[model samples]
Every structure is written in C-alpha cells, then in structure tokens.
Target: MLQTEFPFTLPCGYVDARGNLHRQGTMRLATALDEIEPLQDARVRANEAYLTILVLSRVVTRLGDLHPVDVRVIEGLFSADLAYLQRLYVQINEVGTTLFETQCPRCGLRFSLDLTEGGDINDASAGL
Candidate 1:
C-alpha cells in the first residue's frame, strides 16, 4: 500500500532559533476531523488566516533535524514555505490524485502536472 503522507521541500526553508536550516518535511492527508477540529481553536477563530498554520502543524509530521514537528515550527516558517505547504495540503488531500491541471495564459496552453512521489511540479505538458 502506498503511504498517504508525502515529503516536500520548503521553497525558502525554515531556520530554527539555533540558525539551523530545515528544509525537508512530510505532510499527511487531512481527515475530516482534522479540518473540523481546528475550527474550534481559539487562535484559528481569532485570526482566520491563522487557520493555515494550525492546519499545517497537524499534518506536517517531520522536518530536517526536527523529529517532532510542532505549532511553533509551523509558526516560524517563511511566508513562501507556508504558501507552498498550503498548496501541497490541498494537492494531497482535496485534489484526490498525483496530477493537477495547469495553464499558461500567454500561450493558452493547458497541461497536467504530476504530483506523485517522484514527479516534479514544473514537469507538465500533457494535453488533456
């Protein structure tokens, strides 16, 4: 059976308090309860945008040199990394597959990008 979790690299990476650069991490697919429970958090309720940080902390299990990921870790991530993980969370859980459709407005080209374990995000050109 394939693992429901997937590994990813932060676009800008995270820097710990000790100045260690942490880039690689794993995120598991979100369950209904996972999405629902965060809504009850006072922090998430106070800052709607903070929901992403909360959601991410729950799914991200590990990061470079960080055996046990925590909320503070997610809170310390760079904005670019936060965005990347948000997209990744959607890609893995809600998108429901390893491939997604993309388009280039300049050329009116629509293509499918593979998001599987070994595929690259920019490696897409298949016609639907």
Candidate 2:
C-alpha cells in the first residue's frame, strides 16, 4: 500500500515557549491545494521564501504534542530541522520513497541512495 504520512525526527528540533523540545513529528503527503493555496497567502507573497513555511505548516500533521502544526510551529523550527523537513518533503512527494543509507563495498564509504529512481543502482551512483 502507498504511504500517506511519514515519521521523522528533527536534527535540532523545535523548542516551544516552555522550553520543551519537539523532535519527532509526522508529515502527510501534500495535496494540490496544500501547494496551491499557500501561493495566495499574504506572507508568502511578501517573501518568496515564506512559501516553504506555509507549505510545511499544511502538510505536517503532528509535532511532539502539537496536533495541528501551523506556521508558527514551523517558524520556530531550527534551521537544521527545517532543512531536514524540506528534504523529507521532497523525498516523499517528489521521489516517492525515503532515502536509504548504503555502504560502497569497494570504496568502504557510506552514502544515501534513492532506490525508487529505477534503472541500475550503479547507474544512479554514477550521476551522484
């Protein structure tokens, strides 16, 4: 079955007003409206970069104890955490699968590979 939501652990996590750390969360697959409606938001209009904030707020279903993650919650996220979520969003929505860590047997180096891209895994590594 296709997965609609993904669980994640923030690298830096979001700190609430009470000094609570929210490291774990779940983000649902974004709908067309989630992507489109954010474009009309005044905040996004004022700052093109704010689009990520809005889009994330809509797709994130839960964060720690927070039930309905909103723009404020997203804005509170540390830069590292925000970047992590952004990468996660793209992986699930665009790539259709989460990245898996693999070790190169010959080189003995660790790397991540997107298995859903099809073709030979070696061919995919060539482009990396």
Candidate 3:
C-alpha cells in the first residue's frame, strides 16, 4: 500500500487590462480523477509531475489574464491537489476487495479467487 499527502491554498488576484494587479477573494478550479491516477503510479512519478504542470497551464489559459506570480501560486496549489488525489487512491485500494487469478503450482491449473468485503478468500465460481 502507498501513502501520500498534499496541501494546497488558493491565492487572491487577477490582472487588469492596464497591466495593474487587483485583489480577489478566491479562484475556482476543476479537478479530474483521471488526471491524478498516473501520479499515483510509482513507475511514472516524474511523468505525472510533468502532466500536472500541463493541466495547470490549461487553468492559466482559462484565466486569460494572470500575473506570473499568480501562475506560480496556481502551480503550487495544483501540485498539492495531485498529491492529495494520490493519497485518496491509496486509501481506497487499501479497503476495497479484489479478485485474483492464480495457477496451481502442481498442475498449472488456473483458478480464480474472490475476496469478500472483509478480505476473506472464496472460490470465485462457487455461485455459478
């Protein structure tokens, strides 16, 4: 099982047409589950970080007019968000049940096992 954590905070600001800065209360951001899964995969951690930056770039594009500092802040927040998502997937897998397919070491016969909600092993074809 993998355990991870991430923290994030939104900043207050937006750029004006005259290149002036204005103070704002909060910013709205959309997060997707699919976008965060690769981040959870240990083999692709570096790639995940790069993908997160791409997603942040899309957010900045949507904002239309944001100062460079604001973009940096947003990037930090998105990174934290990705980490949080990774932690969530780990917790879910820890509690959820899974079915396993196995082969007999003696005869090479394939068999399936079902894991109950409580993690007990049972023959997958018992009810069939």
The regions of model 1 sitting more than 4 angstroms off are: 100-128
Per-residue lDDT of model 2, residues 1-128, tens digit only? 77788777676788899999987789999899999998998988899999999999999999999989988999988888898788778877985454643455577554565556463344324544
In candidate 1, list every pair of residues with a backbone clash.
none
lDDT of 3 by residue, 3-86 (tens): 222121222333454665433221223246535654565544656446544544333322333433243544544344445333
Model 3: lDDT to the true structure: 0.39
- What are the RMSD figures for all models against the true structure? 6.9, 5.6, 18.6
Instruction: Give the alpha carbon lDDT tens digit for every residue of 4-84 in model 1.
Output: 877776767899999999987788888888788999999988999988888888889899979678899999988888887
State which candidate has the highest lDDT: 2
Off by over 4 Å in 2: 95-128
2 versus 3: better TM-score goes to: 2
- Candidate 3: segments with Cα more than 4 A from true spot: 1-9, 12-45, 62-64, 67-128
TM-score of 2: 0.77
Question: TM-scores for all candidates?
Answer: 0.76, 0.77, 0.22
Lowest summed lDDT window (length 10), candidate 1: 119-128
Candidate closer to the true structure by TM-score (higher is better), 1 or 3: 1
The local lDDT score (0 to 100) that residue 103 gets in candidate 1 is 48
